[model samples]
Every structure is written in structure tokens, then in C-alpha cells.
Target chain A: MKIPSNLAKSSLLATGIFWVIGMTDGFHINMMAFMFISYIPVFVCCTGTILLTICPFYFFGETKHFSKRQVFQRFYPYYSIVCFALCAYGIYENTNETFLIGFFVAAFFTTMQSWIWFAKESADETV
Target chain B: MKIIITIIASMLFSTLFYDQHIGLNLTVFSLVTLVALGISNPSKLRMKETLIVMGLYLLTAILVFFNHSLLSIIANCAVFFTLVGSFSEATSSVYVKWLNGIYSSIAGTFHRNFEDKSENKKPWNEDVDVLHLIKIIVIPLVVVILFVLLYKDGNPFFEEKVAAINFDFINFQWILFCLLGYYLFSNIIVPVKVQPATDSDLATENQLKPLEPLNEDNLKKEKQLGTVVLALLNTLIVLYIISDIAFLLSNTNFAASVLSNQVHNGINALIASIIFAIIIILYFFRGNLNFFDENKTLKNLSYLWIFLNAFLVLLIIVKNAQYIDAFGLTYKRIGVYVYLFMTFIGLTTTFLKVYQIKNLWFLFRKNVSVAFMLLVLCSVVDWDAFITNYNIKNADSLDVNYLIELSNNNAFILHQKKDRMVLKSNQGARIDLKYSNYVSVLEQSNWQELSYDNFKLKTDIKSYEDTK
Candidate 1:
């Protein structure tokens, strides 16, 4: 509540900007204003995609027993690293356009994993 | 904040150089991320764990440099994950912690965002703030746009470059690269936090309890039952051992078929029986055999039974080696060897548990640690290369098709030895087809596939082709 934290707000805004920039094929004057206004849709889509992929783990009450710290610290990094490597290899092989798209999605998830966990760790420690 | 900024800058720099060469790009990426992580979380690793992690990392790096095959990639991922998980504060299983982190990063972020929006219910003020932010960006953005347009119109060179920027064809590849860069930066700056398992958590989870106390009469009955069971098992095992010596060790010319049968069929049942025997002994002697004055004979018989199981494991290993020598190596054979070794260790540890009168947890912990160390040790060896080389040297029994599909690490050797190999008709055709496929893959590979092994293989193949 009350904007959660600066980090969360900034991350959402950053993701929105990335989506717009990525989808628009770089900046052009005619659509620049429109794209800027299109941040709302971009934000909604990105948020929905992320939440859709991740919310089932929570809704099923998987995290009930283990706290976030316990869950993230043990195995998330390994999963992220493995995903990152596979995506990277796909990119390296120049496989297909889908792999190209997949790399970004994998990278984003990997980065967000560390960001959220680390931010929470620092926050808890500071508090 | 500065650390985060520096990490982001490094990420951008790495992305720019991503296509330079595979090895160089990966090295830069890994080093920068490590640096950022070190700066953000300056916790010192324990000497032993640090050494283990370093060794694993070094091995993984070498594997990658050789070739970024799926094995190397997975191994490298394992190294980093294990390093981070071991150092983290989490006492839970590493996998559970990782999932929690992923879930929090995505679902938690969205939940927080919604909650924040709801709490900020003063829509007018929020809209004003948004408008103010937009206004701040709009003025500079509009000015930059006008200046860029004017400059493009005035200068032909600038105009040419501006026109070259095509908005119609979006390169998702570059976008993916940038995303990877940013993600690496973020990961380094913010280390995941893990919580140690608490006492309450352990209590809530059901734990194995040692056998409860027995009354005097029940204890007497257990002692009698243990003695009969131990005596009968020991006699049967000793007879089996004697027969093994007569049938296996005494035979000078061991047939491959017999050895294979012994290993495949006999060893499995033997191991299972040994496990059953140990469980039965534990059941009977759990609370009754600890007293030395009353159940000495039963205790000694149990010890002898364990020793006999160890002997059987040794015999199984010998048979397995013979089978391997006769038929060449396969993953299953290698796995069997590892399994036998673990079985040996398990038996030895169980014996120690009984003799030392230790608790079950002690045995569990020690065996688990031993298994983990064994895995780490195995990870150090390049099993693909080892298998390929062994099979090649024993080419009479080599499965060429299997060798060809092993890993890119084996490709160089296969290519080099292709001329000398006298393949059967079907095998020969398959090998040729496989070799051609490898050549095509090499040709299609871009700068991203640059590695010491790939480079060497390419050059070797080129020379071979030129000679042909």
C-alpha cells in the first residue's frame, strides 16, 4: 500500500517503458506520443503476464509452509540460471524468432527473481 | 543505488560486446555479475564451501570453453545455483527457496502494485502527480525531437543515418539481449535472502523416532528372535559367499554372458536382500542389542551379516567391471558402478551405526553427505569424453551411433578417427550421415558458438576434408 516501495513502482514503470520501446521498433515522431500514452496497456499486459505465470504457485498455497526467504534462497537461483543458460544457448544457435522472444522473457524473470528477493532481504535487515 | 547503476552500466557494456566472441562475452558477463554481487553482498564464504564452489566454477568454465554443450551449460548453472544456495541464509531445501523467490518476484510484485494503487485512493492527486511527471519528460523530449529533425534535414550524412533507422522491422534479438543484460545487472545487485529452518518448523514436520522401550519380557523375546534371525541369515550369507567364490572367483575363463547375467540379475536382488536383512536386523535389535551383557552373540552375528553384505558388494563390483570390459561402457553401467559404491558406503555406515549405538539421523546425515561429495566428484570428470574415448579404444564393441550422439566433445575425436573406423554397411552409412550433419551444424554456427573445442573441431575437420 501507499506505492509499496520506490523499487516496486520503478520496476513497473521500467517494464512498461521496455514493452513500449520493444514493441514500437525504436522511436519515431508520429507514434512517439501515442506510444507514451500506451504505457497503460503495456503495464497491464506485462503485469497480467507475470501474475498469470506466478500466481498459481501462491493460490495453491505452496508458499504457506516456507516463508519467502526460505523458498527463494534455496532453489530459485538454480532454476533461473538453468533457464537463462538454455535461453542463451537458443540465442547462440540462432534457432528461431520464438527463442529470441523467449530469451527476453527468461531474462526478465531471472532478473526479477533476484531483485525481489534481494530487495526484501535488505529491507528486512534494515528494519 | 550506485552499485545498481554500475551493474546496469556493466550490463549495457556486456550487451554491446555480446556478439564479439562466445568465450569473451560470457567471461565479461560472468565477471561483471560476480563483481556486482560481491559489492552488494559482502558476506565472506566459509573456507571449505568457498573452495568447493570455486572448484565447481573452474570446472564449469573449462567445460564451457571446451564447448557449451547441454551438459556444460547445465553443470555451469548447477555451480552458480549451488554456490548461491549454500551461502544463503535459508535452511530449507534450495529448490523450495528458489521457487518462493520466483513466485514473490512475479506475483508479489503485482499484488503490491495493486495494493499500492488501492491505498492511494486520492485519484485527483495521483493524476496530478502523473501529469507533472509527464510534463517534465514531454518538454525535453519535444525539444530533442525538433533538434534531431532539424539536424537530419540540414546534414545529408545525418539524414542518411536517421532514414536508415527502420521502425517497420523490429529486431527482437537485440531486445532480448538488452533484457538479458538488465536482468544480469539486477540479479547481481540484489542477492536473494533465505531463511534458516527454525525449531518450530522441524517440530511441525514429522520426524522418525527410534524404537520405543520394551518391557523386560518383550526385551527377552526380542533378544531370542534376534539371535535366531542373525544366526540363520549369517549361515545363509556365508553359504552364498562360498558359492560365489566357487562359481565366480574359481573360474579362470569367465564368459561375457555369464558375467552380464550375474551383474544385471544377481546384483540387484543381492543388494535388495542385503537392504532387507539390514532392516530386519535393525527392527529386532533396535532397543534390545545395545546392552552388551545380554545379547553379545546376536550383536556379533549382526556385525558378521553386515561384513558379508560388504563382501557381496565387492563381488558385484568385480562382475560389473568384467561386464564393462566385455561389452564396452554405457551410462547404465557407469550408474551401476556408482550405485554399487553407494551401497558399499551405505552398508559400512549402517554397520557403524549399529556398532556405535548411534541414532538413525546420524547415519542419514553421514550417508547424504557422502552421496553429495560423490556427486561433486563425479561432476568433475568429463564423462562424455571418457565414455567416448573408452568406447573408441574398444572400437570392436563400439556403438558408433551412440558415440556420435554423445556430445560435441566427442565429435572431434570421432571426426579424426573416422577414416580408420571399419564400419559395417548400416553403421557406415549412419556414421557418414552423422558426420555430414556435424559439418552442417559447424557451418551454421555463428560467433555465439565460438569455443576452444568448437574451434579445434572446425580446424580438424577442415584439415581432414582437405586431405580427402
Candidate 2:
């Protein structure tokens, strides 16, 4: 499959961001490089590093089919749904109001650009 | 009869890896691989060949059953691999297509590669029918019941009494995070408009026809709405992050004393239930709207507002929040069990979803490779410092002395030597210190550093979290 130019750029940007974050966070890039050369088994660290690298590739590759506009539009509902599930789980496990409240706020902020935010105007106009 | 036989065979095999009973465990697992292979490829065999394969599979798996040193990780990998290979082979076989629709469905996956996607609008093959039949129908009805009766009490490693379960709310946390991520991506990260692509030729030809952008006032209004929506979502993200950190800070395992001080389980359960109910209601309405594009945003935002208001029900009933026990359940046995189930569910759905996405082969290969590498690494890594830190956090909250002593002990000393520690106790106990190395023995054996287990040894290892 041909990689779209936009997707390639996105992939590059995501990878660059990941690498920066990973390096700054003290991930062992050097160790990973060395370990990759030697067929020696270092499972967890190696896998983590590999995943960090490969995940960006998939993320980029996946967006090739959709236009940027389409991609952006598809994002919010699924993202919100996952976050909602995570926060709900947290509330259940922690049983802390503060934590639950915090998750709720996170969900809210994350979903701010969503169409649901302008429901009132639409409803009013209709009325 | 075929179904019953298959179920029995499956139970016999599953027990080889996971059964808690000794007699059945040994006999069943000893040749489980051979049996499973035979079951998968009985056609290749003459009657004699089938028996031999079954016997060999059972013998080999059972040997592992007895070889206490054999890691469950390796066995699990083997099992999944076998399942994949068998399923693929069965899908390709002529018999699969000839006898019933199962083969046709399986073969269709391969045939799909040849089909024109545009022409083939009809969906092909229920990928999970077999697994579902096994998990939902066969296992629960046949295997689990028989295992419960014959084995008695069922396998401790896999079995949890459904009636006694205290619904864990934590497993839902990851799902919530996914939802939040979706919102962030669609609404905040990128905004789209449903405008038609500009007609370039028309623009050049028709000088009199001016290009129309959406009205400036409309744009401004949309921008304002987008900003407000983003703000709300950002707040939600912030809250999730903050709460996550807070929960991590008050680590239950670390602060045993504090965790022990938790309120009654009933109150905790009730609070969680109420919150969950409210969230579920919100989610129900929230499902109606979406966040992707400008046109959709206006409509979807209305739905989101209604959802958010519905969520306020929990806040109004603040009494539910007051009942939290200061120190929650210390063991995390139930919590881990619940999370494990959720993880299993996650894995299962991920598999089903990949199939549904129609990119099963690509996603399967990528995810399996990553998953295998991660699981193995997690299994084998030396986690002394991490474990030590965790222990210190959990145990030191009450008695610093215990923490100090534990830190000074050989385990700590060994951990300090390298980032990854490998140490063995004077007793035949080996320590991997990273993920964890434990064996719960019914009887404390005489202390001697001994070789790896030559025979099957049944011992209960506490949850990795509770190892300290």
C-alpha cells in the first residue's frame, strides 16, 4: 500500500514527538540500539522501546485511507468513549470522589470541541 | 455428541495448563497437545494415527504439568499458537467446506483476498463463532461444571464465584481513558468542516460568481463553540490525569495501614454502583452525538450537554461519596481478579474487533508479535528495584523498621547489584525479583537450595502485588 504524503508527515511528527518524550523521560535508547544488535534477550525494555517505535507507524499508516477532516471527525467519539470507560473504572476501583471528579473533568475537557457543545443553539433555532 | 466430545476434550486440555486438580491435571495435561492436535487433524490419521497423536500430546503436556519449573507463559504461548495453526489448517481443509457452513466461512477469509471489495458488499464469516461457542457455550455449560464437580471447587487460578463477586469499578477506567482519547482526537486536536471542495474550473470560468466562504459571523460563532467544547474536554483530560496521579499516590498496597482503614465493603460497593449508574446514563445519551466535523459538532454538542447534565445526578447525591473507607481492601485479590477478567475481556474484544475491522491478518500479526514480546519480557525481567520500591511504599507506611530490614536483606542487596536482580533463597526457592517469583507450599520444606523441580509441585503464589 502506498503511504499518503500527509500520513507520512503525521507519522514522522508523531515519532519525533515520541522519541523526544521517551528520551527526556530517560528511556534507554542507547541500550535499545545495542540490544537490538545483539540477539540477546531483554524482553520488557526491548518490547516497550519497540512498541513506542512501531505504534507511531501503525497510527500513521491507519490514517492514509481517510482525509484529515474525516480523520479528525472520527476521533472525538471513540476517544471520549474510552476515556469515559477508564474514568468510570477508576471511580469504581478507588472509590474516591476527588479522583472520580477529576476523571469527569478530564473527560469534559477532552470532549470540548465535540458537536455536543453547541446543542443549545441548534435546539433554540429549531424551536 | 461431537459437541460434547469436543467440550470434554477441550476441558481435558485446558486443565493441563490451568486445572487445579492433581489426578486429572497430570493425566489430562500430560498429553494435551497431542490430544488437541489429534482433535484438530483427525482426518490425517488412521484410527491408529489418531490414538498415537492424542497419546503423545497428552503425554507431553502432562510432562509439563509435572515439571513445576515449566513456566505458564511458555505453555500459554504454545496453546495460542496451536489454536491459531489448527484454526488456519481447518479453514483450508476440504472437509470444513463440505460438512456444514463452518468450512465455507473459514475458507471465505482466504477467498476474500481474491474478491473485489467494491463488488463484494456482503460481509463474510463470523470470525468468533467458534471461540464464542467454546467460551460462552461449551466451557461454561460443560467444562466448568464438570471441572467443578469432578475437580471440586474449580481451579483457584481461573475460577471466581459469580454470586460472591463485588463488581470492581477499576476495569472500566481504561475504557474511560479510551473514550476521553477519542474525544480529544476528534474535537480538540483536529476540527473539520463539511464544506464542498472548491470548484477550481468553475471559479476560473465564472468571474462573476464569487467564492463563498461560510459567513464570517458564522465562522466566529463556530470558533467560539469549538473553543468552549475544547475547554470542557481539556478539563476532563486534566481531571483524569490528576485523579490517576492521586490514586497512585495513595497506593493501597503501599499504605497497608491506611488501606485497612477503608469503610465497609457494602458502602464502597454502593457508592461505586451509584456513580456507575449515573455515568452509564450519561454515556447512553452521549452516544447520540459525535465531535468530528463542524456541521456535526453543532448537532452533537447539544447531545453532549444533555449527557453532562445527566451525569450531575451523581453529584447531587453526594451522600454516596461520603462512605469511602479510608483504607481500602489491602489484599487486592478481588481487584486483581476483576482486572484480569477485564483484561481478558479487553483481549477478547480486541480480537473480535480486529476481525470486524476486516484487517484481521495485519492487526493480528502486529499485535501478537508485540504482545508476545511484551509478555515474555514482563515475565522474565528483573524487577528488584521496582518491586522493592513498591514494597517500601506499601509496607513502610506503617513500620519503617520492616522496610529497612527488608531493604537490607539479601533480596535488597541482590537488587541493588544490578538494575535486574536474580537471587535464590537458601531454600529451593528462586527469585526473579522483577515480575515476581513465588510458590505457596502447603508444607514448609527443609531449607536447602535445590535444583529446579523434577516433579509437579502444587503451591499457591500470592498475587504479585501482595508478594511483599
lDDT of 2 by residue, B1-468 (tens): 333434454444343323132333433333443444345445644544234323333433443333322333253333333233333332221121111122111222222222222224443443556656657874576455455444433565444453234435433333333443332222211111111211221122201221344355555465466546644754563464455346544643433333323323323433453344334323322221222234344334433433433333222222112222222112242233233333333344333332222222333334444443343333332232333454434432322223223321123223233223222332112223321222232123222211122122221122222443
- Per residue, candidate 2 scores C-alpha lDDT tens digits across A47-67 of 343244323333553354753
**Recovered native contacts in candidate 2, as a fraction?**
0.00
For each candidate, the DockQ is: 0.15, 0.01
Model 1 in CAPRI terms: which quality? incorrect
- C-alpha lDDT (0 to 100) for residue B99 of candidate 2: 19
Chain B TM-score against the true chain B, each candidate:
0.70, 0.27
What DockQ does predicted model 1 obtain? Answer: 0.15
Fnat for each model: 0.11, 0.00
Q: Which residue pairs overlap in candidate 1's backbone?
A: A71-B97, A71-B98, A72-B97, A74-B94, A75-B94, A75-B98, A76-B98, B90-B194
Interface RMSD of 1: 10.3
Candidate 2: stretches off by over 4 Å: A1-127, B1-20, B23-86, B89-228, B239-468
How many clashes in each structure? 8, 83
lDDT of 1 by residue, B211-258 (tens): 556366767778888889788888988898788878876775667677
